[model samples]
Target chain A: MENTTSNQTAQNDLQVLRTSSLTGALERELEHLILTGELKPGERLNEIQLSSRFGTSRGPLREATRSLQAKGLVDAIRNRGVFVRSISPKEALEIYDIRAALFGLAGRLLTDMVTDAMLARLNEFLDEMDEIAQQRDFDRYYPVNLQFHDFLIRSTNSSMLAQEYKSLVNRLHLCRARGLVQAGGLAVSNHEHREMVDALASGNRERAQEAFFRHVERSKQRFTTTLEK
Target chain B: MENTTSNQTAQNDLQVLRTSSLTGALERELEHLILTGELKPGERLNEIQLSSRFGTSRGPLREATRSLQAKGLVDAIRNRGVFVRSISPKEALEIYDIRAALFGLAGRLLTDMVTDAMLARLNEFLDEMDEIAQQRDFDRYYPVNLQFHDFLIRSTNSSMLAQEYKSLVNRLHLCRARGLVQAGGLAVSNHEHREMVDALASGNRERAQEAFFRHVERSKQRFTTTLEK
Candidate 1:
């Protein structure tokens, strides 16, 4: 009886491991769909279609959806199914406010912990972004700009904070596709990015924090201008 | 052909919904387990034991674990089972840094949106905390202080920001159980809480933001001193 019970216990453990791995993969797939706009905001998730496409059963897929819901990527309604969360203009602006504070905290922490090598990496992006800005290459500047801000947060070495910041950036990216970079905005934005590097290099915690906080707030302003048109 | 396809789709949809709700309940139960210390930190989760205890299958249990993982309450290791994440003193301090920025953002946002009624509610808590502090009732002050911070975040009316703030608070709660409140810490903490309310009432955004930001930083400092012992 003891051997049989232990054997059954081992079998259950493997079953959980398999289900966990499946859930992880399905979560990523669903996140990609929502983030890329393939699923579209407010579009009801069709379990049958997704299950067939992914070649998985409904059990794992539903689990994945629940995970997405926890991440704020999807919302479930009573009696109705889950749908990709719709970000309102007002909501996007509010997210920007939260992001600004997170960036500021990143700056404060990074300034305290930054090494010469870290400064060098940041400056490299700073130089590249400056060149892209001068060339009025908005498209190229966008991705480089993302890397610069990302590096700033990651430099803090706080995995939890970095994870939270990335989630905010992902949601912001959805709203970003709606608006174009304003005229001369690339130069202005890159100018602030330079200021951020200088502050970090100066090792002044307050200055570094302010520089990052204002940068995101300015970006929010620029985004608002696009929405007003 | 269309009728058959639609009918089959409906069946799959119901299955998904049933699974989704089951996963939701399981997620909450698992969260409660981790938060309540019933499942100690770094303790490996026994899938068979949990499934049997909850009277559910592994599918929903695994999904719930995934959700908890997303929330940073659980850790999944390759070839090993899930365990309650142990927050070291260092990780706790790092989380506090993130929480500072979030609370600061809440203050800044709340200052802009603070109605007369909101101010009244905040002040009531402020007064209650003051009384508790004078009584040297640290135990009573703790829960009331938590409510004050929660109300500050919720006042922003940004569901996304509020959700993120709540998650940070939850993680910090795990760390909080370790350190005891220092002598007269409650009074000092409550003093800062009043300053936050004053800044909000004054309608000074910068002051409100700084007040809230520094409050969390000071709390971190207090937490660190305890950990050093």
Candidate 2:
């Protein structure tokens, strides 16, 4: 009886661990759906549908929705349920301004903190990005583009800043997905990334900061110009 | 029979609405508890205890916990339950750096956007803060101090920046409660607020930004110093 009870307790513990990991995975999938625009702006997310889609229970589904709501990716109504958040042009401009500040800070910190190995890694990433841009393989380039930003944030060794930056990037990604597709934007973004990497390699904090700002500003211009048209 | 059915429907709807609002309120309360350090760093939050204290159901309680986790104020451990996040000194420094970047952007935007009426309202807040400072009432000054920051954010008319700033403020507040209890630090902070308000009134963006940076820098210094001692 004692052995059987122990086995049952261990099984229950494993179930709890499995549930926690499942919740994390569910959160990521929902975030990706919003970021990729599968769930468009102001569209209500049906819990029953999402639950079946993820093969999760209502408890975890509701938890994931709450997480997204806090990230500003989703908004919950009292009776209606959660919906993807929509951004206005004005709010988009504000987002860019915030992005400029955040990325600029990251650049400055990256310059200060970049080791020889870090620079080499960045250079390696940039080389791959250049190849992707040359081939116009945006499908491959898009993920690399995200990795470059992620690299800067990670190199700062600041978890708090990284967390805040991740939230901003998620929102930006969602907004960017709604706009008209710009083929040239990727190449332009690559050029800016090269400039940023060069500034960091040279340890020029001011130049790095400026390059980072310009990068975000150019992307913002593209977004706004498209939005206007 | 019709009346009874309608009454039941109304009750159900009301329950849903009440739960939603209760979840929000619980989130705010839990946030305050974390920010004020009434809930100590790394302390576990029991679901049953929290539900009873907030006078809510487990559903709303779990929902509120999820929200707090998203804000980076809490962390969940499956069956073990949620715990308030502990910010290390290093994490605190990174937060201040981010704040400098964010508030500097806000200050620059405020200079470009500040109207005469907005300046007047800012001065009114300053005056009230000054009166409270003179009385050496830290408790009364705290809320006013927060209002001043909130006012700047709102004045910028950037919902995105405002949202990001709110998150930064929440994280910063988590690290500040203990450090802020020092008399000298509190006085210096009050003085800094006065200087920031003056800079804003003069429409000196550079000065305003500098004042804002110094304000955050001073707080960071105090917190680090207190931690060391």
Which candidate's DockQ is highest? Answer: 2
Model 1 chain B: weakest 10-residue lDDT segment is: B175-184
Q: Check candidate 2 and list the clashing pairs.
A: none
List where candidate 2 sits over 4 angstroms from the true fold. Answer: A1-16, A19-21, A127-137, A180-182, A185-187, A201-207, B1-20, B120-144, B185-211
Expressed as tens digits, the lDDT of each residue in A1-229 for candidate 2 is 9999999997885676576656666888888888777898889999998999877788888888888888788888877798898866676677888888788788877888888998889889989988888898888988788888888888888887787777776776656444544556777777788899899888887678667867887887887777766
CA-lDDT, candidates in order: 0.83, 0.79
- Provide the TM-score for each candidate, comma-separated: 0.85, 0.81
Backbone clash count, each prediction separately: 0, 0
Best by TM-score: 1
C-alpha DockQ of every model: 0.33, 0.50
User: Which segments of model 1 are wrong by more than 4 Å?
Assistant: A1-20, A181-184, B1-20, B181-184
- As for model 2, its CA RMSD to the true structure in angstroms is 6.5
Could you give candidate 2's per-residue lDDT for residues B2-30 as a string of tens digits? 99999999898578667667778778888
| Candidate 1, DockQ score (0 to 1) | 0.33
